[model samples]
Target: MKKLTTGLASASLAALALGAITPGVAAASPAPSPSPTADAGRSAGPAAPIVSRIEKHGADRIALLGVAPWAEQVRMQFDGGGSVEPVTDGRYTFLIDKTHLGKTATLTSFAGGIEGESIDVALTLDEDAAPGIIPVMPRVLGVSKDSQGVFVIEGTVTYDPLQFDQLEVTASTGGMPIRSVPDVNGTFTLTIPAEFAGRQIGVQAHLGNKSSAVDTIDLLETRPNTASDTHPLAILSPWAGAELAEPAVTFSGVAIPNSQIVVTNDAETDQRFATLCETNVLANGKWTCDSPRLPDGEYSATVTEKPTWSSVTEQTEGSSFSIVHGDWKPAAPALPHLSSITDSGDHLIVRVVIPGASRASLEVGEHRDEQQGINGRFSFWVEKSLAGQTATVAGLVDQSVGKALDIPLTPIADTITPAPLTAPVIHHVADEGGHVYLEGTTGYAPFEFFTPGVIAKKDGKLIGSTELTYNGAFILRLDEEYVGDEIELFSTRNLELSTATELVVAETEKNSAPETFPLEVTSPADGATVPATSPTFTGEGIPGAKVRVEDTTAADKAPVLVCGADVLADGTWSCEAEKPLAHGEHTTTVTEAPFWVSAGTPTTTRGFTIGDADSDDEAPIVVTTPADGSTFLAGSDVTFTGTATPGADIALHLGYGLAPVIGTADAEGDWSVSRWLGNAPYTATVIQSKNGKQLSGAHTGPTITPAS
Candidate 1:
């Protein structure tokens, strides 16, 4: 504006630089007037309260210590009010939320006004509270220190815990505290607490908060510091001793330098044995352990660990041994040894001698051989069948002190035998028509053909014998019952006898007979009494003949004539009489065979009546009742009666007097002749066929039977 006043003072310095570039121009700041160095860092005495110490720096940061550094804008709050924006430097890293695990967090930090730090951090996100504490050790796989100074700790206790309590178990050369309890699958059983029995301990374990790091186990009872005229630990042999079959037994001793020789067997009750080889007594006190095969006897060898303070003077007073084993001894009753034996082909050799004995035990019957080898001599062999035998040789003189002696052998009978057959022979001939030819001679074995007695039509057919092979031969087939036969040839091991002189047979030719005719009863055509049933015996032969019906008064009876030959197609031989003929007067005989010109006289004969067994005396009134063999099927129903004869006329007959007389018997004589009697065997003869025939008498009416 020194230009308008310089252009209006440059527009009033561009309006105070557009009012300090507008925007409330610092709210027109007239209030900072009482500043005094920012009011001495503002504080209400207690507002100097940031006082922080928010430690917890692992698992996503926290460390906010403050005595003044302005606590770097802290303000963390979380526990679902979820704030955590802190971290300007006082170290606050808050992303929390692992579901805010057991949360509770605070951390405030007001700036210039001085209220700097406030802290209450907790959120640990449970990482199992830093777990991983598994240490409970006591591993002694197998320990042995026995001489009575006692050392037996067999162990295993890895990582144990289940409310675990007492277990300090220490042992470097010193150990004790074996109380245990872990059996529900956790497994722990400790036992070493006999007040630490004989020291050397150094094993450690102590659980609960855990502490286990030392493992040295060696309570070696004794056997190391030797001096003062040593040699007093003798068990010259017997950790395990027995010499029956010999192969194991070596327990030598003279210990002092760490003495331990224990070889027990006062019948061992758990003196726990197994220590096959330990020897360290060398200052000239010798020691050895070589026992494994033991089996026959008594033993006791003791020196059981001694040397801790030393005190065991040349001890050796427990020996009661015996292992006499070389069984099978019994041969001094004067020498004739070998009592029995046998083996034919594959090797069976025997030779025996046992005077004193080096070794000998051989029994064959029930097989026995105690390391057989008697220097005087002995041999044995037997595979399967000891033909007929016996063997016994028992001689054992020193099998570590046990003596034996016996001898006996005898086996005989095998002289090579089996052979017989000299010039065996047989021959027979007829060759052409009826075929009869046999020839033989064999040293080969195997031939047969025999027959004896019962050869009718040609006199006793005898071939008697011929096992052959030392001479074999065969052939003979004369049909027609061996046509005029005559056979006899023998040779089965020298029974020599043969003969078959030109036999011949051939003659057969004759066949022309089968045509006869004469069996005629045409229908009911012969003494007809047509209805008690079954009647059809027509005739004419040879179309397959065989027709029979003979009741010539019953007894060995003969019924079969159910017809065939095409009934009437002309070669006519009809049949049908299976049953219906009892009322007396039935002489129906129709036999046929091979043809039949009456087949020998009776191809037919019919009389049929079967209705007269009823002459009434009160029980015989079965009128014309038909069924003991009634096969009449044509229109069925045929019942007729006749028993009311106290006065006489009870006439009823369907066909007995032959065909047609249906009913008549009223005063309770009961008459029923229901018609339809068409098919065959009918003879309803309650006769009196009518007044003048006279022989037809018995008609006592009403009796229609058959329901029971």
Candidate 2:
């Protein structure tokens, strides 16, 4: 026998007899088999051919048959005829190799007279393979119903198989089919039929090989219709039938939720409306409408609803009311009537009357207000420009308005005038110098004066008539004239006219004897030296005569010494020198009895050095001591000594750093100062002053050091 090929092993073994069979021909049976059973069994007729059977167990083994009932040795042949030891007791076995599971195989047996029997069979192995199972039905999510009693089904489905072909859905109600579909996600729409509007239904989902659990859904009828009468609508404010302006009239009211509103005039024409325009009502219930201003006439407005009560209804018969135009009347007593308007530079006043009215209003341009006065007699201040210009005033009564009346006026001016004149009188007298004095007076608000004419011939033969002052009175000084020379005095109010007033004039020489001298000075003789103390003067003339000694250089100059009257009783004149004079010559003049004239031409001319020593030079010496550009600390002692022309008065002036400082020097040419210096540069100057006048020379100094 040949070894079985790998391909045929499985098929060949599996086709063999079951485990109960034995393999190979029966062992050669003993020839004496007949004697064994005695002659009765008669010799085993030609030893029964050794018979063998083969069988397979599980999938890996094949059994072979043995010859005797319990024969042990047995052999088998596979499809390729290869022999293999097999199990005894009629069992033969071979593994159905996985490699040959799908191939065909044959097994044959050979024994005695039993011809070879061949068994051909296809091989099969139990398989553990499992196929994926997936659901084919879509998930039923939810359902929706429309007013028409139609139902809409919505959901999604999943199919994982590559060859999946179709899906189907079916929905039923009370076991009655309602809808069906062939695609997974496809929708199914159906009407429940009017009879089933409020009924319940069951829904089911199906795929090719699977069906989903059933779910229940309910369908409901559409909302019921709302009744008009149950929802009352009222015109809360501008009540129905109210009439208003055509361009603008407001109407307001309240209504039920979702209710319809309509408005119209008597003619049934719709009026424009707005719900927000109405006030005092909830948003869901309020409404307002504006009507065009009606003509000046009567009309009616109506608010209504159609189809009073039906589900689909019409507007109602509106509540109707009458509207009439408003009575717009002008208030009484029209602006007061002005007859005329006049003004002074300051104010304008108007004349007006309100006939039968007690109070009236007056208006200038746009101004108006009630004015008070009985029978409307009122006045108003008019502006200056309104003067001489026309203004209008209207008169009104009850419902009757009147037109305005125009008025005009003029202003006045002011003036002034002059007064009259009067005539004057004259008087005359003569003095010891043969001079004549004439005086006169004029009678007028402010009197005038005139020069009296002298009558050389007593008849006014004066060559020229002198014109005197035009003021109240006059005085004339006439020079010497012949004694007893018939003089006349004449007065005239106007020089151009020949009018005159004359009085006999007699020239009498008064105080004929020459006046005696009243005073003379005896002390401080001419050219005498005087000290800085009070200087005295003795005078001899008339006892108790008034006298005065004046520094001639200081005379007629401002700031001169003024003497009191008592200084003259002792025939002595005295005065204190306010300032020291330099060592030099100075002249002092004396006057007596009267102050206008000098007694004898400065009776005392003197030269005296106010210092202890004297020098002859009259020219002032320039001092350079306390030298220029010198500086000292504050509170430092400073001395200045300089020699100048003999009679020069040297005054040292201390100035604050470029500013003027006040100080003084005595008659001697020496100066010393003990002053604290300020905190700035300073200048020191030497000044020569005499007779209230000064001459200065300057030198600057460095800034003073402030004391620590």
Candidate 3:
């Protein structure tokens, strides 16, 4: 293809926040540390996911602008809905679809291979609910100059996308921006003035703050058919001129596969090529034909190809050949091998070694080649443009006998020096209208070296990009509309982006948390048994969290399938086993999935038998304080106590719909939680588990009744 594999560095805004590859460093260079530090055993783990954008209804496109730092995986669980895990490249943004208004999404990140904190995000319907547009990058397919001298460029964007509304064209040689409207299929065509011929031009699609990678094309007055894979028409055998031994002349050559060749005798006598000589085109494009006996001395023929496809038909002049009946033909020379191809920036040095030939010639594209004596070696200098094309080396051992070999060419980049490193900083400010600013110190010096670029993003949206360290300092300005906006500031030296620092804005400033839907440990009574197959677990969690079942009987406490359940409207939930369980005593735990930050992270565990319960494994739960059927006086500090399986977590529930007071059972199966009950007499229920973070179970000590 005529198009080269190149990247649009400045314009690929969507591609900047991706992957872990460090920029500017070669395989032998020192490894640079990540901006927020490496992804090793970090105790702080991944940062909580921020709500980047939330579209109300249309697509319900939910997004978080920046990826969670150090997150290997991220999961989202909507209260009463299933979870969507790892939906992004952990870069620019994380995305999911749903009309999640008034509902919360629990975002949990795992970093350094450890489960981190889960943050709840709920977006309100407002102008800020929608975020910046999705980025569309256009790729140039082909470029050519029309007969009218105008350059025609064609390209495509990823989706028949609305995101690609405008095509922006810029020329490096100076010119105003050229714009074009792209069709619905994400395809666009535009023309550049003839003056741009021989100059490099860059084209990309734009949508607000986002743009695709630029496709730079070097314009040629008349585009050669360089995109075609069909090799240019040529004669590869009996090469050009070969004296024949017998008068029954025969000719062979190569051309576009399956073509019809016509050879005309150029002699003044009748122009027939001795018999209607029409050769069959081989799959490999080789063809041969035999001519009737001829009393020939020296002669030339015009060879023409009539293509079966749309390719142009052209005539080629065959080098003159003579017919010598006494067998004066020489043996064909062997193929040639390349000794070295060196790059001198503007041109290349090609050295070849051919055996069994005293003289040879080399041709690279349209370069003029000269015949040179070959003591098994010959050298040629060719244009730098031929770096990715092919070169041919031919040897002539005798009259009418020769062979040619093709070798590919490649370019080399030898002198590469990187720019010095610069550290960047971002300052956090509360929401208020004013001239906001950030300034920092840098140790970077400018000695004519290419400096690292700095891009500032607010809520995962590009805000500004600036050239840093001209003389070791840089400045950027922002209006008040971005006050209280979260932005990440970092320096990008090579290909990799290290998240430098962030200006955090608390969502609570604009959004209030949804009412804390009650969480209850209310099902699968502790020590209850059921069939080994289709085991069922049930519970109730604060709105916006799913329930999960875990096999707590095991040493490591493995998950029971992906066993999960959406919460029922009435503050209850039920989940079924994904697979069959073993017919033995087991301790199962159920807990709200994607642990939340606030209160109500309720969990419960139950020991039950699939076939027969092991009496020793079953631990009965007991509530010893605020005695059963008893009530504490209103406005009194009450201490409740319970006992269950050793090391089990405890949740003491007061009937006033408040968050559970949590405690843990010790080795002796003892647990207690003290709470100040205010203004109302209340009953209490105790729910115990094999572990605290387990699932919901039926409340024990069902009543401790007393009137206010």
Candidate 4:
């Protein structure tokens, strides 16, 4: 940004000085340096050429250059290309292929064959109509005026239209330019007053940090578009190419008000058809719906919008999104707008457009109300007298709070008497993993919440708070110390919300009931014979407990672990046997041991026979490939080969919770299925009927770990 001593240009600076080109070097002083550092003892040579403007002509650049001695016959030479004699005004044109963009090019002026200093300029196509910068002018397609004296100018963008922020239209003679956002579909429309009619209007497109050349069009009046307040269905949230960590998604977008919007994803066709929600568009012209859970992969949702009084429906494909494990979904910024205000007698119902927000807050004066799990449209109720006041709106989505927006509220109408408050009632209660979970509903306003709202108080001491959502559902978790203590639950700190409800903690922390079946086998019921010795074992037990089923058939035989699984939060567990058990009568014992305890409780002894060894059976089913302890690399095909009874259909489950890959045994009693494996570990299980079913199915080894 150094400034050169202002010296007169060689009458060539008008064409040599560049302006407003993007990704540009800061504009240096147009005059040549007057420093006497070079050739001090003799006549200093001619100064290097200065580039003032660069015009794009197809793939070539017309550089308006400046030289020190305009009258001298100077040969202008460009680096990596041949030179051309510059006109008396110093205009140098050269072919700059697409490859030359962003590359540095040198220019030197030769005065009487003595080369002067050389200057370098970075080649760039980014141009603006502003002085010193060139451009690719926009094209104006049509112009018209409506009956209301509004002038409309429409145009077609030849380049990437979706990336352009705005297009400016102005009367070329004299007037302020009107700016309008260009549609992503390569078209734009701008409206101005009748003052600019019959004038040649210029159009310029502006992108981030760059602008296009000014293109002009004769603004002759024509027929105006007759459409009312209407817009195409557009999906604004979960924008193009978005990736999400969670499976469930909430699709939202803008459409014409009252337009019926049906949204469907490209997953589970049957469910997609049956679960489509109609008329998702709210009164604010924003539509949204909670989507069903999707599996990990790339997916797309399409919206079909059907307007009232129209039999035709238009469908638009939304952007693709990926459901990836552990990937974070950043919250989109919400522009909360005051959608509507209704007089509901007792209160003023104010609905705001808080798109993509889970929690919304409406603040007027000093009072504020917040709603959690907000959907497409969130409404806030306030006193009728508070209408016409400005309110600040905010939303929280994806754990990100959006910028607060202030919007003016409309005047409210009539009002009525307020209802009396009632105590909140608890409906369901349970104890799991030492914590009390309670679901309840309150008779007070659902949107109201305080710092210690819905509190659990022990002996008048503030303890905990829970929120009652818009659906009238509230859950509270208490510590083990409150298992038997009597606690009072109140709706708000002011005591105006609801009366206190007194209750005692029914159960917590322990599930040591001896009469209940603490541990039992759910699958392969106790006495029923199983076709496969390596069968999957699943059962329910107390939360936080670990269950292990071990074979103790022999009096002095070492116990063999048939299956082991930790109880889930919901008291369910399942695991498979990596090693096949020998086919014979076997007695097993179930042990339930909570993680916090040292000893495991022994349940009833269970006996089950495998394969009915006494009956003459067919060929034994055995897994041949994926030997025990075999390792696989990512993307490798994991092929499972096993022997099954001839002519029998086989179903093989490669890992837990996975659907079985079905195959048939060949005439020679061989069956195999191959699937691509990711970087993970898996233990397999194969199943068949017990009639002609062999009793063993496994790799007969340890679990296979795929290399990371």
Candidate 1 structure lDDT: 0.34
Identify the superior model by TM-score, candidate 1 or candidate 3. Answer: 3
Give the range of the ten consecutive residues with the poorest summed lDDT in model 4.
1-10
- Residue-wise C-alpha lDDT for candidate 3, range 615-635, written one tens digit per residue: 345477777676666766543
Cα deviation in Å at residue 606, candidate 1? Answer: 2.6
Worst 10 residues of 3 by lDDT: 1-10
What is the C-alpha lDDT profile of model 4 across 378-415, one tens digit per residue? Answer: 55656667877888888765455665777566743211
The number of the candidate with the highest lDDT is: 4
Q: Which stretches of candidate 1 lie over 4 Å from their true place?
A: 1-531, 535-545, 548-589, 594-602, 609-615, 618-708
Alpha-carbon deviation at 332 in model 1, angstroms: 95
Question: Candidate 2: misplaced stretches above 4 Å?
Answer: 1-147, 150-196, 199-223, 227-230, 240-247, 268-283, 304-311, 326-708
TM-score of 2: 0.16
Q: What CA RMSD would candidate 1 show?
A: 57.0
Cα RMSD (Å) per model? Answer: 57.0, 70.7, 32.7, 31.9
Off by over 4 Å in 4: 1-177, 183-193, 200-222, 228-620, 656-659, 666-668, 689-702
lDDT of 2 by residue, 1-708 (tens): 011000000000111111111121001111111121111121111111122223345566543222322122223334544444333333344544344544555444333322122333444432331222233333344444556656555433332111122334555666567655422113233445545555666566554465656655565434333323323466643545544322245565544323345666656443443211222212123344555544455445556543212343544334444444344222233233333333323445444543323334445565453433322234444555545555555544333333355555453211000012223234334442333444433222110011112111133323111112211223333333433455443332111112344444554333211133334444344545545434433334321223344455555653233221111111222333423555556665554432111122223333333323222333454544556555555424455555543434444444311112223454554434443343333455654433323333333332233333
Each prediction's number of clashing residue pairs: 67, 57, 16, 13
